[model samples]
Target chain A: MTATAVRAPARRAEKPSSSPRRRISKRNFFARLSLALPAAVVVVPLLAIIVVQGIDLVTHAENLTRPGSADKFIGWGNFTRAFSDPDLLGSIRVTLTYVVAGVGLEMIIGVGIALLLNGRIPGKGVIRAVILIPMVLTPVVAGLMWRLLLDPTSGFVNYLLGVVGLGNDHAFLSDPATALPAIIMVEIWQNTPFVVIIVLAGLESLDPSPFEAAELDGARGFGLLKNVTLPMLGPVLAVVLLLRIIDAVKTFALVNTMTQGGPGTSTLTISNYVYRTGFQTFDIGYSTTLGLIVSVALLILIFPTAGRLMGLRIRRSRG
Target chain B: MKRRPAAVAVRSIVVYIFVLWCIAPIIWLVSTSLKSDVDAFSPTPVWFFIPQFENYVNAWVDGGMGQSMLISTAVGCASAILGITAGLPLAYLTTQIWPPESTGSSRATLAILLLTIVPPVLSLTPFYRALFGVGLTGNAFGLTIIHTFYAILLAVLIFRSFLVNFPREIREAALIDGLGEWRALLSTILPNVWGAMAATFVLALIQSWNEFLYALVLTNGDSQTVPVTIAGFLSFFGTNWARLTAAGVIGALPIVIFAIVVRKHMARGLSFGGVK
Candidate 1:
């Protein structure tokens, strides 16, 4: 029921007797526009800065450390360099791996857990409350805590491994092969709860009538879920999947805190690469160019699809 | 088809194990924080030890977490309030004043979504340069503005989801009865949307409090937030496991409690209202 209600409200025709209402609405445009002005004031300037400075910075090969470098305009220099930059290519590959593997596992495991929780479980409330911890734990703390746990020496994971005769001193974060996978594991551990919470809510709010009808028709178990439940859940699942992808693409803190995109840049995501360029390297021109390319590519990739999935009718010409 | 008793038992066990996976690290973190520095880093696990309360005291005082906590709270509250102040009216305009299905409403909402989709990395340098030019960097002022900017984006989306289906005739009636649009929102709509507002405030507050990237870039020294402060402990107290864990616990404790208190509203807010 809520699934449909979330769509645009039905359009109703105006009655002639509501002339006063019409007058108010006509004047209400500017009044209503005024209501949104404050948000515009805060947002527009930042957006303007992004565009104005982005163009200015992208055209110049200005290194912050070099004096009088701001006027050294090199048109398309940064963009051209970025295309051949091996680190940028490698970072993109790493980011894709993170988003795909991390989000994929999260969705599957999260949906499974949510489905399990929806069934008859003991202390359901307490179970739910406990699971929320990982989701809300400060990312930096989560990263550091996981780092401590996964530490090669004096770490509980190694201790457990020793007990199982798997060898105690496994350097998870320091090893290049294991480093990205380890970060992705931490990513799954932290964010899977997000998927569970949202998907569980979606499950709980699902209309009961379809299930009743499916049961009456002798549908049961996986068949029932595969047919009745999942079809009805398509929209919610799409939204959840979209959100997870968007967030996972912006993964920085966990990677930064856990490995600092190290273990030979095995886990260097786009954000980490940008931070490295802009702050660590002090290459302002290249950093802004990278930011613009990634931003534009991301929007081109997801913005229209996100709008449609959210049921917003976006026109090409409008805001 | 009802599940067999054995299947039911297995299912329950699977759920328990999942919960265990989720909670074990947190338990380890807390337990390690209570151990002595040597015990925390013992090559072998220390199953028994006297608890150390001084670690908390040390993390709180010596680590500058206390000061950072104040900075975080002030920034979080200021950003959340500013976000809601700007966001609610914009949500109202898109969902209530304009027909939600109309071109204008869709356009407005799409603009908000576009802003939401644009990664912060794109704007980070520009914002840093702009704010630094005005001497707003290295303090709470610039960071608060950026956080408020994001909070507004969050607030607008969440509020729009809640208010889109709210009946508009009530507001129209109030307008006809001589309540101005602002007055109508305050009297007629605001009362109904306290839940959304609370959800917005809590979520926005959490976002700002937990935010690290911008905080790291924009602020330093006394203005650092919880994440920055706790992260700084890593370099400052490299081998002091107990102190570091204590700092971690201190930093994560409040937000964990707040989230549990408001978990019911979190699904909607976190999903940007997709679930609701």
Candidate 2:
């Protein structure tokens, strides 16, 4: 059923070949142009920026901070400096930690909640609505709210911790040891719902015959879940993981608002590092280099995953 | 299939606990917004207090959030509009006009989608440099143009997925009646995809509204949006919990309402129609 639905459009696209070849070519030319025009409008400026920045980085000509600065050639200097910069390298490590921790927790908790919600439940609509609140709230506001909640002196979170006999003065955001963890906690709290929603959607759309067959074969509870449900959910989980990793790698707003990459740059993700470099320090050349590095990293990470997703879709369409 | 009472009871408990976990911080925010400055800052948790409605007034008036709200709304709407207008035609071209299996259009679509992975921080300086060169810095319209670029990826992805699944028979029928591809798209095809369009628009609007980095770097003073302004309150007010919480609530209010209103389309939109 799923395969056919996926293939229906592909089949239709192949059907018009009997028409006059000239007419088809004309239509295709006009259509392609229309599509390419909008794409160019968006992509051209971005490409120009990247190319210009790339040239500037290599030549060391323009100071992006000051308008109309003269160009001077400085080959590979920014890249070399960026490689040796402890802060940039440290930010990369911090970003890796955040991406791994944030995406991992969100996946586990999100899938767990999704399974729980997949069962017949009362007030499911209300529950789903409530869960989506954090996902919808502005990240800046969410970060601020967490900052308020995690305040050392008057925070509700610390108050609850004290009530439960956990130490309350941890100063989660201010202290270096606990700051990254605190930011990760807030990230998980806000984004776990996204995973829940996506996983739940997948759950709802799943084929039920396998579960029924598993039940008839004496499978129940965790056995059925592990054997029947999870196998079917593999593709959905892959897509969700891809999305979450991309989002997690871009963590900036929360860190900026809550910790300001503070207590000596412990919480500085690569994005925040780049922002500080470009805006605060005004090292436009180095910042652009850092940006390019991040872009390269993202491309390496995403290309394989995107290709896998494309393969999955094509297989579905073909089957 | 008989259900066990114990299992059902445990599930209910888990569900309610999860709901409370999701909502607790928001409840605390609202409570803080309603507390007096002294009560808000009390070392002990303030469970009960007379609701301070005046905090909303103070935040809205004195905090400059009203102007921010107006600016955010205008930016969100303008970007969503431009994004849709540009994105839909491009999606239509990729899905319907170009052959689906062809390398050209699919490659273009993939390239566009890949653009999303490029961290916005990387583009900020160049965007800043370009906008400054054009004298568009700190202008809402300039910010809108930048946002439109950001929004295009979402718009194209959602609309392309939707148009791919759109029935081809309708387009064929419209074509037999002598309509051009553009006309058929506008007249026959677009109406059928209103739900998809709405989903795309809402997603884009919420993104533009919630966006902080660009809004922070690009706009200043009167053109500042709510997120930037609220962040500003932290530096300017320095632990004024009452006004800050109130401002936070006000800043989050519009998107929250919008989210609920379009709750049904959200999962589909967020997943880029993958799950749905």
Candidate 3:
């Protein structure tokens, strides 16, 4: 426009021109172009990859048409098959059980520790950081650490068990019955502080006056906690629970590292199964459908948990 | 009040115990790394040993972590650079592009947030196949792109969080200076956000350095990174404990030291929302 303005002509009777309008237009174009760069570089590839995969899924429908390939799909039929598959069904049951047990244990232990450390605990800051170490430690590292400690041969766990005269050297990770439970235990050990942190936020948000007021009314101890304390904590607790459930449901880290979904399908969470199909079995179509199922399953569990958490928060604040 | 002191002591001891549980394994690995092969595997599980440079030396030279470290570092830097290049402007555009005071259209953030939670593994299947086709399946450059995607999502989140604090006047001033949109962003906005950009970069660096599964599946050769070096310490049949622990210590030490050094920004990055 400015280049054209110079070309257009003999209309300028003013003695001086600042060219403010020209500068502003240049700036707008520059800002828009630069700003668009960041999003373009990142999102374009992702969208491209997803689109390519989508095409692959569609084009390969025949290969996945039940008898043609091991993946067993004819377009949306794969998704329906994934839902009806007994292995997937079993995985859902197993995964839910693991989530409930693992996260439930974490909540109890985390809340207990938080309450214990709620006030004038010695080295509280150090303790708080220490408690968070598990969260920071990679699941692979934790798995390796536990693997060494739990190996029936020279593991520290066996050594400790030997010391206590409960000296049955258990092959924990390889045992079908014990494998999933062992993973749950490891998850509890690692993630309990995640619960503690959230609950600690609830605890931190507390005003001592309410507890004192409750004390004045002959409400004390468990009753005080049940009434004043727990209610105040309901929102945070809801968030914590929802967080734990989401984490637990999607949890593949410790399980993959520890068991690799072994001894049967006993340790096979939806994640591991999908991974097995895609990477280990090299069945893209089957795995995509399986992966899609896992995401849906996660969504199903997550939304209800989120709703419950929000509802619990809302209702607790009503009084 | 007097009884409370005793309670405090008890709690302190408990806290110390838990801390010990957390740190002890890593400590033991480091200690073992410092020892000779005989001392590392003693029935006593040697709690104390004089530090030696052999394990680390072997890890770097003989164990081939030097090469892997280079790959990891290069990949990390590339990812960070790519991520910030893409994320900063996108974040600014999304935040500043729209009319701020509007209703029913604040969903740019919500969309990005959803991407953050979407497991990277979900994309892995496609990435694996796609990379295989493009001959990037086991390439360092390919891994860089994957990390770049992961880092961009996170970097955008970080920048977007800070964008709330940006002086709109700076943008306005750039406009007044006759700078075009791109030039204004490059000359004015990026300079201001450099600190945040560097912070996000460091975080993404650490994340890429520590990442396992993607690297596990992606790279196969001299291209592979640090975590691969660490995992390779474990033999398929297991119980090469001495070498494995040594490798683990070697692989993790630099990152640990780096983390400790940058811990102030590190804390802010992790609990980015807690301050407000």
Cα displacement (Å) at residue A35, model 3: 1.5
Best by TM-score: 1
Residue B270 in candidate 3, Cα distance off native in Å? 2.6
Residue-by-residue lDDT tens digits, candidate 1, B1-276: 357778778878998999999999999999999999989999899999999999999999999999999999999999999999999988888777776666667788888888888877898888878888899999999999999999999999898888877888998889879887788888988999888888899889988988888999999999999999988888888868899999999988988999899888888878776776
Steric clash count of candidate 3: 11
TM-score of each: 0.95, 0.94, 0.79
lDDT of each: 0.87, 0.83, 0.67
Sorted by TM-score, highest first, which candidate order results?
Answer: 1, 2, 3
TM-score of chain B of each: 0.97, 0.96, 0.87
Q: What tens-digit string does per-residue lDDT give for candidate 3 at A1-319?
A: 3223213332331211244554454554565666667667667877688667855663354232246663434667667777679888877777888989998988887777777667776576666655655655556666776776677766676767777898747899898888888888888877787676656655875667888778788886579778888887766666667656755676665667677888788898877777777677666676776766566556654654553333343233222
Q: Model 2 chain A — which ten-residue stretch has the worst lDDT?
A: A310-319
Let me know the DockQ for model 3.
Answer: 0.31
State which candidate, 2 or 3, has the greater lDDT.
2
Cα error, residue A115 of model 2, in Å, equals 0.4
